[model samples]
Target: MITPGSNITDRFAIVREDMHRRYGQYFYADTIDALLDEKIAQAKATAKIETFLPVTVEREVSSELEQRAEAAGRSGTARPEILFVCERNAGRSQLASAITHQAVGDRVFVRSVGLNPSGGIDPQVLEVLQERGVPTGHMYQKEIVPRTVHRASVVVLMGVDEVPGIPGDRVVRWDIADPAGQPIEKVREIADDVEAHVKNLLDELGKTNFNAA
Candidate 1:
């Protein structure tokens, strides 16, 4: 059973073995363990709840490593990147980002941020996501990087009035309710709305470019 209390070193070994099995090209014995440890420790330090903590750590750390591995193997290109922004950065922004990442994958570089960051991502949001099978491990962004606003091809505003001086053509705003402090059922309703918006955005993105990866 997955638990928050699983042995850390043992979990690291499991992640290493799986990384090798699935992505051995990305796994280097001398470096991968340390990288994984760094990521897991970071997650442990930031996570608000311990539920399925090890699973969350493994999924997120592996994705970060995978992106690095893939980037190291290829030339750079200016892919369409979507940046989701909100005040708290923990709930609505993250849920939108996560759905976008899953729905749109390598077709776009996806990120989310907050104006005033919250302590870790909201745990209730994570709980609602668990019910949707969307994997809530990677919404760990705690700060809104200014460069993210400049770098994005599209900026999505959630439950925020506005971001000053962002081009009108590049910004999209949704009127969905915030996910923080809402009951699980209400949050689930919000998740459904976010998923619908994600699907609409994906359609607007055109057909996926399999070659982008």
Candidate 2:
């Protein structure tokens, strides 16, 4: 928890510098500052651990900036973006996202979020992914933000029925069990299922080059 007198400014400064370096060509300093401040406030409201608030805010800002750049045809690639959504974002969606990243590398851009994000990731989820040599360093629990949904080329739903405002054509539903509080064995099974689904999705994506419309 960040206290009133904590050095939040220092933490925010780091985010500001990094954002300016990456996105200054597209956004004004003041605009970035305002967006950064809004993200920080939102993070404080929803984040269970404040230790990585700055990093989370930076990610949110970067996502929005990337969307804006793409809209303006400034982003270099027309890569199809995939967003995985689930109830908590700790298990099912996370598994699918990590597996997709492992399978596709940078050929596709993938992200996962929860409807109501809470707690950290399930330990078993991390263990299973690590067992498969999948990278989990960048995986974090985050709530679904509006821009996130709007920017997705494909919104994959796992144990989630629907998300408001997304066009029906962009959504894909998966019937996967939640891995939270499950045993490692069960978690591994879930991981296997997620891996299979990811492989199929990749194949459907034709390895690369997709028309997301």
Candidate 3:
């Protein structure tokens, strides 16, 4: 647990050691450390309970490293990567990524990012996602990172304009409404719309056995 005046250096060292052991072969030590700093900084900015910051940073770094490995064909079976992007990762992109994960599981790698990330997830969005049985444990508002863009097989953009890092062929726009401040009923409607798009995308990707209703 991080507290005011607590020596964060030790905690960060532990996280760095864990990551190095897991991804030392695939990525440079400098790269791992840089990402560790980035994740910690991001997590600290919005963490409700400072105690969970280390755990959150570790998980975020591991996810990024795993995606990097898969993108470079260094990991095991290469799963199709899907990245969902919106203005703020608090609503639409979160729904899309969570719904897609609930549908395909690990058979396809899923990520969500914002052009300009918000401080947290939307409460109404959380309610709708829980109603659909999608796990919200790993969900967070993340700013789009370069490597995350470069690795995606498909990038779904919603309510946002150009993503300068990714190729045109990989981008797909969804006209779904953003649920940031909408009523619960409207958020549900948006969730249904997101689910429909996710279903079709999984079908197109040949991962047709979707479990997301």
Supply every candidate's count of residue pairs whose N, Cα or C atoms clash at under 3 angstroms: 0, 0, 0
**TM-score, one value per model:** 0.59, 0.62, 0.64
Q: Which stretches of candidate 1 lie over 4 Å from their true place?
A: 1-77, 146-149, 165-169, 207-213
lDDT of 2 by residue, 1-213 (tens): 222244566667667756765676566769888988899888899988777787678789989988887898775535566788888888998988888877766566677888888888998999988888888898899775422343567889888765645433477888888998888999988887887777777777777432221
After superposition on all C-alphas, the RMSD of every candidate to the true structure, in Å, is 11.6, 9.8, 10.0
| lDDT score of residue 115 within candidate 2 | 85
> Candidate 3 at residue 150, lDDT?
38
Q: Candidate 3: where is the Cα deviation over 4 Å? A: 1-77, 146-148, 167-169
Q: Summarize candidate 3's per-residue lDDT along 78-183 as a digit string, tens digits.
A: 4677888888889999999999989877677677888889668998999898888888887778775422343578989899876547543477889999897799
Please give the ranking of all candidate structures by lDDT, highest first, separated by commas. Answer: 3, 2, 1
Give per-residue CA lDDT, model 1, range 1-213, as digits (tens): 333355655555556545543444344555666766787778779988755566776787668777887888843444566778888888998888777766655456677778888587888888877776676765686564322343567788888886745432478888899877899989999998988777777667673422110
- Candidate number with greatest TM-score: 3
Scored by lDDT, the top model is: 3
Question: lDDT of each structure?
Answer: 0.69, 0.75, 0.80
Candidate 2: lDDT of 107? Answer: 65
- Alpha-carbon runs more than 4 Å astray in model 2: 1-77, 167-169, 208-213
